[model samples]
Target: MHGFAARDDVVRSGAPEDDDTVLRILVVEDDEGDAVLVREHLQDGGLPHETVWVRTVDDALSHLAASDCVLLDLGLPDAMGLGALQRVLAAGAPPVVVLTGLSDTDAGVEAVAAGAQDYLVKGDVGPDLLARAVRYAVQRRRLEDTGRALYQSLVRAAETTRLERALLPTPAVRDPRLEVRVGYRAGRDGLLGGDFYDVVERPDGTVLVMVGDVCGHGPDEAALGATLRTAWRTLVLAGIGADEILELLERVLAAERARPEIFTTVSMLAVHPDRRTADLYLAGHPVPLRLGPPSALLPAGQRGRALGIPVGGGWPAERLELGDRWRLLFYTDGLLEATVGDGTQRLGKAGLLEVADRTLRGDVETDGAVRPDEDPVVGMLLSGVRARHGGDLVDDAAVVLVGWGG
Candidate 1:
């Protein structure tokens, strides 16, 4: 190697002594004479630059790993012709500019097809062309990197939306004796949170429904929520009762949860269609309010702790008869956590019931059908909470209203 020292390393560009931004180039060439010739041309071109020469394919790869632009001589002693070009391109960001001997412009063209940004005929090119080529390759690589980053961002955003939609529950029981509705609002605009719900109708006509909130916001929380909802649905379909399903779900919560601090508050309801009786299982969650002949919060008995963070023993499922045309409002804490005033006091369960009473009793139209007391029940809950909070709630909110149309 003529004056050309072989070093496996990256070349970092420094501002020229004259204060101009200089382009950095990694030259992959085995011949010292050729490397010097290329550098002379680039320096002579009045363009500021520093070239780091690597002689072998392995050395070039190491340099590629560290650097961004490559001025690659197609024919090298260790890796010859287009093979050298391909290896460099595959390594990373540096767009390649092929260096070719006079008779080998064809090879240079072929190298470009294999992903080289441009080619230079060695003996025929001057300093201006050499400098311009390296600068152009750098600009090209920058654009390509920007585009790749943007595309990945778009893909990630779409996945988050899909994951969110998958985790959300759709009402399953359309009993003439029940009116079922659901509401969900993500606290952060364009962000996914850990709220989830699912309603499944078993072969025996028992409706198994659940609503839960994993303890955070973002993709990880959303993903775990989706996993938990899916597991719950599968367990219900497998004919598991509420207690057994909760135990199994706790196992999943332990295994699939991304963080140890993460936990879930869930409520599962099993409605027996024939007898019109519903079994309620609480797992450290907000209780469901039974809006019966007189709309009110059905008592949420003291029971199980949050899943994964077990307090002690298991929960005994409670059974209740579904009154004719009853509406069950199941919600996440975000609904009640909304502030009732500028003070530290929260809406709490009792405060929420008060709002529900006022709104449900007032003429509110929901689903376009306004019974004397049948206002937009779900809307009132969300809007009323926000009005009291001074704005939207600080956390993600979700709601499910199961109305049995007697």
Candidate 2:
């Protein structure tokens, strides 16, 4: 192969670009004479490169990942013509430049269409041309990869916007007297989860609030939550009572769920305009927390099975007198179930209540008081839960707090 043969007095492109980046290149050529020429061209081109020569396609496949680019010879014993190019590409080879014979220009053109970055005539390739081909091939392939990733990210962003709108909707109350606040945070990975909520104040000045979780996480669970939320808003707009609305919601969940094991926990309320009472419907969910005035978490009633459970029915309303001035909070389990200390125990309901007390009434026993600038808000409660978790919560948390008066 004359690998150490006399240096060919190579011709330069007159433009000596200084590039110190060493490229790792794979040469798949059975002919030793041609392999020597490829090596000489790149070595003489003044391009920093690590060249590896292989005699067959099988050897090339092993080093595909390690190589930044590949120079493939079309006329190989085992791999003939376009078949060699097809095989390399099928094995997920890197950017490739095919070496064809003088008269095989037609095959070279066909190779580019078959995914080769570029093709060169075996005898006519020069030091400059060969080096440029390798560099451009790698650069072009990298651009294509970046473009594909960006397109996929744009698609995901659009889908997320649609799902978020459905999951969190505008309040329907016209009454200025009632104040409502809500916040939602996804689980650990920042990927959206199944927790969702919706609030609508009815025409009679009665306020409706619901917070629920569709079992599991990801786009599918998120989609189901959005679907259920839309249905809840529709039922509320139609003036369905709290219990019947829940029953209908259960049927919708069972029908729409992708798997039989999938179920949903929900807490719904119908608060009267008088700002003094509400009808609560609980389904395997945490009891509502009342932070101010005449109430707190009292045993409401027999909590029914969550929607999609096999043997559950009769969703009934448990009435409550919320008093004239009250602050009521409803949330998904993500807030209370987060891990607290050494991970052996979870910051269950009691832990959350401790934080909630500090967030509102500035109880200094635990994490000190909420600063004067920070008003008592549900978002603060969510932040407090995340702090108690020691980081991001392991589950999606959704919260809605409603207040009637001072």
Candidate 3:
């Protein structure tokens, strides 16, 4: 190749009319005659090619970095064959095409695998072959970059999954009288949607449990839900009542929200271990169902709107007895958002209760008989909704069942 000369022959911009014109190529061949021949062929084949020859690997690395394409000769004084190609690829050079002699076919194959776009045999290739190879190599590298970006996105999603699990709160309870079971599923699959739950055992021996759903589904909403759950637990530990806790949550939701439209629905359950009495508070959240001998849907009494709405509004609270061995189920709205038909009608609270009752009594007719010993009440309720929709719930669904087994 010709000695290093600071010339402006290569690396020119595209024409004004052809804004997306052909790319400029830099030929890094140590042999001066071979480099001249390659440039002649590229020019004859109607390629926008430029030759910048460097006898040593150091000069080649610097020159290739600015070039759109490279034609590298495997045999060089400083680096030979695969070693030189390795240095070029390691230096983060653009797409390169190896110039190999007829005797070094194996070396050429290795160079291509090591990261060269393509390889051509010396003393045999024509102008069209040279031009086509360069164009195709550049296109292939572009596609490879795209694939790498998509893989990175999947990696980020996997990392988010780990973060979501870590954020799930473990119930804090010392009283052996209460057995709390909590579960959550995001409605928009593959993302951490805004749904959260927590259980905290305060210093006063009272168990505080909560489940909430933020208005929108996105990272911002999920993050807000996480923040609210942590704050609620902290306030409960600080000795706040169910009613006051919900009110404070509303204030926090109002202050910390990213947008004015963002709101949250929450249900708080506080149980006294000694008395077996519980207080329920709801702010636009689904009323938890009681599963026991009475097995009925308890009212949450959400007199006020959801959090972040009409900021600082308060809601009414209700007191109920667990009796003995009663189970409470808390869930988000994704479970009830299913449409009964093509119309605007939805399987709302009443319809959900009817399904639960029928499932418990084994009166809801289906193709198969009720499985023996299976929790048919909850199972049937979920199944009924899925059946209506013809498959899994279209929206994300989450459930937390707290059983006060005496």
Best by lDDT: 2
Would you list the clashing residue pairs of candidate 3?
Answer: 1-30, 1-31, 1-32, 187-396
Error of 3 at 50 (Å): 21
Backbone clashes in model 1: 11
Q: lDDT for every model? A: 0.76, 0.82, 0.73
Model 1 TM-score, 2 decimals = 0.70
Provide the lDDT at 266 for model 2.
Answer: 92
What is the per-residue lDDT of model 1 for residues 148-253, given as tens digits with 9 covering 90 to 100? 9999999987887788767885665645555666777677354768889988787777887789999877778889999999899889888887669989998999
RMSD of each: 6.2, 5.8, 9.4
Question: Model 2, 10: alpha-carbon shift in Å?
Answer: 29
Give the alpha carbon lDDT tens digit for every residue of 1-406 in model 2.
Answer: 2343222222122123435577888888887788888888998887778777887787778888888899999987778889999999999999999999999999999999999999999879999999999999999999999999999999989989889889877767788888888887778887788888888988888899999998898889999999999999999999987668988998899899999999999998888878798888888888988874323684578678888889946667888877778878899999888987888788887877777787776442323333344334766777787777777788888888888884
Ranking by TM-score: 2, 1, 3
- Native-to-model Cα distance after best TM-score fit, residue 170 in candidate 1, in Å: 2.4
- How many residue pairs in model 3 have overlapping backbones? 4
Model 1 error, position 28 (Å):
5.8
The lowest-lDDT stretch of 10 consecutive residues in candidate 2 is 5-14
